[model samples]
Target: MDMRALRYFVEVVRQNGFRRASATLHVTQPAISRAIGQLEEEFELNFLVREPRGVCLTPEGDVLYRRASLILQQADSLASELRDLRSMVSGTLRVGLPPMTGSTFFGDVITEFRRQYPGVQLQIIEYGSNQFAGALSDGHVEIAAAMLPIEGEGFLTQTFARERLALLCSRDHRLAARKKVTLRELSDETFVAFTSDFKVNNLIDRLCNQEGFEPSVSGRSSHLDLLVSMVTSGMGVALLPVTVCRGIRSSRLRVVTVIDPVISFDQALVRHRDTYLSRSARAWIEIASEVLGFHVDPVFVA
Candidate 1:
């Protein structure tokens, strides 16, 4: 069967009638009907049911619709991938980032990259943890900055740096006087926590679970700066990455190390195995390696 015929058949099913599909495809109604009829003849199946309101898919048509949808999607993706190759250094680089970490180094890297390749466009998307992983998986982004231990196959990841997670509180809070505090010591205090969607919050939950006590969460914020504001305002204490603490230069807040066990999370750049990364994307990856002072293996290209 001709691919064009298959496309015409799919369009007919989508629009639910020859008239609608013909209008959409810029063809006559009879032409759309002829294409679907040819497809049905080639496949040896009745693909649609005649109805007064609109055409409905038969069982065979439903199966073809599912497969056709995937085939069309893959074809479009292939076209995009081929287009990306011809102009690898000049197209847009879609990047996803978390709010808390990597902002400092990423800003400088982006600036330097733009200076070097002004033709390349940058689309930076800030996503919460719940959305970041899915966005990367669905091809919404070419690369994303994420915390480590991403489970699954068909994904390439490289650790850039390890950030220490510290306990932060307002200077006037009781725990602020200490340079170091244990998880057990903060059991009684009201915690201003990151949302459960974040990896930092997961780490805190695991650590607190290990300590055999659930934290008393007084407040939760998605933004690191907002969480710091809450802590500084004496609403509650928070567990935050050291990178985030660097931004809180206020005298009202103090950073304390978690003793007994120092908690840290590895920051990584993650990409899909099948993604066709542009030259500028690879360049930014190298810049990130330089900024973090680590060597990482590039994803295989074929």
Candidate 2:
């Protein structure tokens, strides 16, 4: 059948009458009726049932309507995809970034990317490590940066950097006098922690569990900066990634390396293996690797 006839049939089905479809299509009612008649003749089946109140689709018409709707929708999407391909670097790139580690590379990479692709728009969504992976899996973001140890089927993970997890405390705290400490040494100390939702918090819990004790969490905050501030104020001690601790060189806070059973976390770039990366997304990933001085491999380690 002609595409035009199919379009007319769809309009008539939508409007529920030839008169309404003709008015909407700017054609005479006879023309709309004739188009529907021609479609039915070509298909060799009755497509619509006439009623005094309105028109109703026959069984075959219902099937054809469903297929026609899908075809039209795909046609529109194809047009959009063609336009995007013609100007590959001029669309929005939606990125999901975990806190702290994301900021480490954002400034340099974003600056360089903008300089390279002036037409591209970058949209960054900040999520905690625990939520970043989920955002990517659920298709809420096109790309994500998260802490390592993420495992699932059908995901592509790239390790970008390795950072130590350090013990942070107020300068006046007793542990500050020591050059280094072990996880067992902090058994009795009160700690400041991120919320239960954070991956870092889970790591801490796992370490504490391995030490045969639960952490004495005195305070909890979602923001890493605020957590550091609380540690500096002597509110409580906290274990923070070296990246974050290094970023904030507070005189009131002192950082010590954990010697025994040392723990490290990897920063990763993750995306779906099956999905195609847009030009902007791929460019941003490349910029990230260059700024960090490391080529990220698609792998995760516990």
Error of 1 at 184 (Å): 0.9
State which candidate has the highest TM-score. Answer: 1
Against the unseen true structure, what C-alpha lDDT does each candidate score?
0.77, 0.78
Clashing residue pairs, backbone N/CA/C < 3 A, model 1: none
Q: lDDT per residue, candidate 2, 241-268, as tens digits?
A: 8777788877888889897789888877
Which regions of candidate 1 fall more than 4 Å away from where they truly are? 1-80, 299-302
Task: Please state the error at residue 196 of candidate 2 in Å.
Answer: 2.2
Worst 10 residues of 1 by lDDT: 293-302
**Index of the highest-lDDT prediction:** 2
Per-model TM values vs. the true structure: 0.73, 0.70
Q: How do the residues 37-72 of candidate 1 rate in per-residue lDDT, one tens digit apiece? A: 888898798989979988889899999877775566
